[model samples]
Target chain A: MNILTINGISKNFGSIAALKNVSFFVPEGSVYGILGPNGSGKTTLLGIVTDVLRASSGAYKFYDGSKPVNEIRKDMGVLLETPNFYPYLSARQNLNIVAKIKGCDAAEITKALKKVNLIERQHSSFKTYSLGMKQRLAIASTLLGDPKIVILDEPTNGLDPEGISEIRQLIKLLAKEGKTIILASHLLDEVEKVCTHVAILKKGELLVSGDIDGTLSKKHGSTGENLTEQKEKTMMEVVSDDLEKLAGVLKTLNGILDINESEGVITVSCHTDELTAQQVNKHCFDNGIILSRLTVKNKNLESKFLELTK
Target chain B: MLHLLNIEFLKLQRNRSFLILIILFIVSVFGANYIVYEVSTNTGHIVHETSNKSFRLFEFPEVWQFVSFISSFLLIIPCFTVIMHTCSEYTYRTHRQNIIDGLSREQYITAKILYVVSLALFATILTVACAFFIGMLGNDPISFRDFRCVFYFFIQALTYIGLSFLLALLIKKAVLTIGIFFIYSFLIENILEKNLNRLNTGIENIGHFLPLSSSDHLLMFDILKTAMRLANIESYAPENAYLTASVIYIVLIGYACYYLYKKRDL
Candidate 1:
């Protein structure tokens, strides 16, 4: 079941359009990532759905078996932009305020602090926390009340490598506990690794959205096919002592769809069944070119993302 | 509403600035009472000669009026406190967080109104306690009429603090909101009142209808005039008019705060 559905949502800041007819759905128990470049309205869309900002047009609904958004929000935690809390208060005190706001038991504060690994420093003031710790405390606030859905905007932004990995692991752990997580991030690699489904937005418009594997696979022009399935055309890289001659001979093959040379390597895309390694090897040898390396490569999300977004 | 207030109070519980503001308010209240007590008791230097009836500042009904007047001078402290508390949410962006955490916009505004109400109640309670202490120490007879000033005192505090809340909501910045509030209360309103009255005798009484002056007129504390029944000096406007104007201002300010909060994006 879809947990949240946003349809035709748009926002305008006076004359400037921020989000234009943006639409997406977050499925239950799925790690959904909203991916885009900066100023792509990722944060604006999140703000609209979370009630931090009202949409200029369109509507969104949280499907929690007929529960009101307010009640649903009690079971849904959100961290937007930054970790907003009273800086004068300690971490525990801040979480205590969250607990009260959510009408949850105070014991959840301890549990949340423990989850964020801030139990030791729970008494320290929020102003004294490092940026990474501040982000972690924000994550911990979302963990309070054992929320069913958690929305984090750029959860891994501005963290050290170790802190990034720690947050990545924590997100995976939360997903393991059957919680649906909606994360917005510009870090393509992070979204690719951590998200099960994604929606790429650009200029306040949704470019594409689907399951991670399916989206990437579809972008490479092999629709509804497993990533490993050999398609009509397969990409292969070859290197030889006579790089120029290998490129010339490879272009002469009947099944060759496209060919390009880069850094002494010739990348060839050809009909999979017609242009086998044996055919390429023999043709190269017959042409006085000794093949040094040849291997088939599976496309990655980075390449597909660059292709689609570009 | 109760839950939201609980959350707001919890946030304020550990706030060092809020604590200091509360302490400062208490000290100012006591200090004002002390000064009044000293002036009333040591009358010889000012009075030139002792009369048959010794002038006592805390004399029962007069004490309530005196305390209420002294306390009104310090109303700016609570107004500043209310502005800080209301505007800090915007500064920290916790107002947005609270809505994200499940509070409706109306609930957010209601929570702030509750905070203002709480502060007004605190000020009213302190005024009544100070009045009682002074009355007891002076060995004066107390009456229900004296306690009526405490009611006006509560209304006055609510009026001022409610104005501050409205300013905070409209401005959303602590320094700017407080600055505008102080200027309007101390200078702008006074100038407008004087100038408007000077423009025509037909509307000479219009100045008394202005928010701050209207509320301030609620508790008249001219001890000398009240004791001597001076013929030349004008007495305060009828109490009902002042009370009615103050209540109207409070409602208007409260509605304005709610309207701004409801219409704006947090």
Candidate 2:
């Protein structure tokens, strides 16, 4: 089931169009990632759907599409841009305010604090928290009221490596509990690791959106195959002592679909299932061309993102 | 509305600045009233006399007027409080957080309006308490009729605090909003009223309806004039007219706040 349906959403800040008729749907129980570079309207799109921003022209509906945005928001947990809470208030007090606003029980505050592992330090004021703790507390806030849908914009924005991994694990755990998570991130590696579905946005416009593996595979010119099957088409870089002879032999090979040389390295694009890296080396050796290096490159989101975005 | 108000109160209860401001208001009101009581009952001083009757500042019937007039000056405390509370939401970006947490725009405005009303009501109750304290301390017998100024003082506080809320909504910055608020109340309105009064009585009559001065006119406490005449003169505008104007200002300012809140992007 589709949890959110955004239709023709557009937002303009005076003259600059932040989001231009952008539209997408978040499916139930999927960790949907909104991938975009800086100034790509990722935050703007999240703001519009969460009603923090007024769209210049557009409409969006949550849940069954029968409730008002505010009413539906009661079931959604959102953290946009930064962790916004009263600096003077402690984390527990801040989350208590959130729980009160959502009409949730006070016990939920305790549970959320525990979930973020801040139960011991919950009484410390928000300003006293370090950046990692602040981000963790923000993630914990989304757990209050046990919301069915969570919208997080750059949840791991300024965290250390350990903190980033912890947030990524938390997101996966939330998704495991059957919550629909919409994560907006500019980090390709984070999305690739955590998201079940992905939407790539550029300059406020959606380039493509679908299942993460499917989108990556399609962008790689796969014939509607699963990611594992798409992996059959791998490119290997081979540099031989005798480059001219190695290139001539590679071109004659059946599995070698395309061969090109730059400077001294010969890159051979071939079907991995038909021709393995060892076979490429064996073939070059049989031709009396000694090889210096041979490395296989499997296509990943990083490469696909750069290819499509570029 | 009550739920929103409850959340607002909870937030305020935890705010140190708000608690400090309320304590200051209480202390200032009582301390000022005590000083007035001391000066009025002193037998040695004879500032004014009417038919050989020395002026009694804290005497009942007039004490209510005196208390209300003196306390009204401290309306700035509540006004500043309202400004700080409303503008903190923007400064902290908690206003956006509140909406994202499930409050509709109208509910947010309603919560703020409720807050302003509560502060006004609090100020009114404090004034009444101070008046009763002074009346009991004085030798003059107290009458319920002496407490009519309490209602005017309530409306007056509402007008001032409501005006503050409107300014905060438009300005969004605490310091700038409070600056504009002080300037308008202290200087701009006075200048305009002075210039208009000089133009002609007709223009000055219209000037009495200006938001701040209109409420100030509600509780007219010219202590010297009242002492010389030995009678409680009514307000410049009829009591009902002043009350009506105050109610109108509150409603208009509130509606304007709601309109702006609904239209602006958080």
Candidate 3:
């Protein structure tokens, strides 16, 4: 059964639309990722579903029968944008508050702390913790009561590389235990590594949403910002005297999805590995042109990100 | 209800601001009363014997009003604590976090109201004890004659905290909220009430129902009223009217707080 269904959810702040007509469902047991770049309304959408915000014109439902939303929240663990805690309270103290709110046994607080590897410093006040420790404490707080559904917004924020990997593993482990996870991230590498399902949002619009492989494999060529999957394609920087003619001539060739020109050189982007420099040179030479410089190199990250939303 | 109270105290137990403010309230309650009592005795204003006493605020029966009146001003100390308590939830963003965890908005606001009520109860009990101890020190037969002043003090505490709570919710910053509250209570309301009194709009008027004017009227020093009566001056609002208006203000504040909380996006 679907765990959550959002129907035409839209939110506006005065004249600026934060989310517009967004709709998607998270299936039970799937690691759903709400993928978006900065200011893409990922947090706003999550805020609305968690009941800390009100949508301008839509509704959402959790699949846990007809319980009131706050009652439903007790069974669903959520860690929204920032890891806010009473600064004077220790990690254990903060978790105790969370445990009481979620109605978990005090015994589980120890287990949650241990899971996050924070039992060693559990007595340290939250303000004394490093950013990574604070993040781990928040993660441990969400795990209290062993909730069925966990929704996290940028859960890896402020963590070291090891901490990031550890959280990803923890998320995977939670999925294995039949608990559904919803993660919102701005990094495609993060989405590709841990998410089983993804909804790619850009500028308050949902570009696509579904099984991760299906969505990334089919839509990555056009979405343009899937940096992790960009490794599957070939990038050839071709330079010729007549940059405009080369760009036009290369556009006519097969598998050449995009071409860009910079400093009198053409950067041809092909989504297939079969397209190589030789084929491009032959095609150019036959069209009465010779290359000045030819090299296969990395695509400019900035250019690719600029081509993000459709 | 117990769980909710526990949740509030859990945060406050470690908060230095809350602890310091509470300590200040306790100290001010005892210190101010003692200093005034000693000064009155030295100045020959209060006689240990009840008879032939002039301006006997420290004597039996009158001491109840004296202590309550003194504490009405001292209550600002705990009122600051109340403002800090409510504003911290917003400052820390825990109000949103609490709702996200499982608390309905109603529960969050209800927790705050209960906290205010507890503070009022504590302030009242302390005042009553102070009154009882001071009243026992007198040689004359002591009576609980003017004890209703203690009740008025409780209502005044509630009103101060309720208004403080609402202001914190609106302002969301401790310093700014307290600043606005102080200016309104000390300067704005007193000026407005003074001007409204001069207009002579009649005995029954909206000015009588100003958010704080009724509480101020109820807790007015009994000596001040007696001196005014001796000078053939009249009270603009009757005692019962002040009591009724104060209760109405508390009820209205309760609803406005809940309504604002329910509608706002935390």
Kindly list the per-residue Cα lDDT of model 3 for residues A1-310, writing each as its tens digit: 9999999999998999999999989999999998888999999999999988889988999995477888878888888978889999999999888888888899999999998899999998999998888888888888888899999999988888999899888888998999999999887667677788888788888777888767644545433555555555667888888888878788878888778887776777776466888898899898888889899864433233335553
**What lDDT is reached at residue B154 by model 1?**
95
**Candidate 3 chain B minimal-lDDT segment of 10 residues:** B44-53
Candidate 1, residue A156: the lDDT equals 77
Q: After superposing candidate 2, which stretches have Cα over 4 Å from the reference?
A: A217-300, B43-45, B48-51, B54-56, B200-204, B222-235
Task: List candidate 1 stretches off by more than 4 Å.
Answer: A213-304, A307-310, B44-56, B201-204, B222-236
**Candidate 1 i-RMS (Å)?**
1.0
Write model 1 residue lDDT over B1-266, tens digit each, in one string.
67777877888888888889899999889889988788767773365454555555577877888888888888889888888988888899988888888877888889889999999999989888887887777666676566788899999999999998888888989999988998999999999877766667674457877998888878776665475347644445678898999999999999988888877677
lDDT of each: 0.83, 0.84, 0.84
Which pairs, if any, clash in model 2?
A: none
Model 2: CAPRI class: medium
Clashing pairs in 1: none
Please list, in the order the candidates appear, how each scores on TM-score for chain B only.
Answer: 0.92, 0.91, 0.93
lDDT of 2 by residue, A214-259 (tens): 7776543222323445454678899877889888988877778888
**Candidate that would win on TM-score:** 2
